[model samples]
Target: MSRAYGDDLRVLVLAAGASGMSARAAAARFNIGIAAAIRWLRRERETGERTARRQGKPRGSHLGVHETFIFDLIEGRWDWTYFEKVESSF
Candidate 1:
């Protein structure tokens, strides 16, 4: 889902809604998901905005917060068995 649905498609879907087509119908007409049509319509109706927003992960890994801990665990116990390291990390 790196690619947000194109504005070209959004326009068609929004046009269908404006012309009294159901989201399901518009989705079928445009070969998209019912939820996508529904969301576009709802956003237009509520906020009067029809542009696609940024999609996908907002930032880096959650485990970033534990970087130091992970590094210390691995470096401090180089001789430990894999199972021992795994058990200690948890």
Candidate 2:
């Protein structure tokens, strides 16, 4: 996946705004998407932050809450075949 734009490019785009250039024009000039330019401009106007927002932790698995129960069941059946384990899981 593509990475977020850096502060340097954000500053350049915002500077274009200060110079009376439209967000779409700035985006075209910088080879970035118009929506990205608009969003970054909005972020800078609202919060005055040029840096990208921090990403939150990844979501936990749906089965995570049953981890202990699942592990215990497996530990007690170490000799079970893979298919047997799969069938028993249901």
TM-score of each: 0.61, 0.57
Per model, state how many residue pairs clash: 0, 0
Residue 58, candidate 1: Cα error in Å is 3.2
User: Against the true structure, whose TM-score is highest?
Assistant: 1
- RMSD value for candidate 2: 4.1
Writing each residue's lDDT as its tens digit, candidate 1 over 1-90 gives 457888999998999899999999999999998898999999999999999987776978998998998778878876888788778766
- How does residue 44 of candidate 2 score in lDDT? 81
Candidate 1: the clashing residue pairs are: none
Residue-level lDDT for 47 in candidate 1: 99
lDDT tens digits, residues 1-90, model 2?
A: 567888788889999987889999999999899999998888888998778876666767989998998788878987888788788878
Off by over 4 Å in 2: 55-90
Q: Candidate 2: lDDT over CA atoms?
A: 0.86
Please give the CA lDDT of all the candidate structures.
Answer: 0.89, 0.86
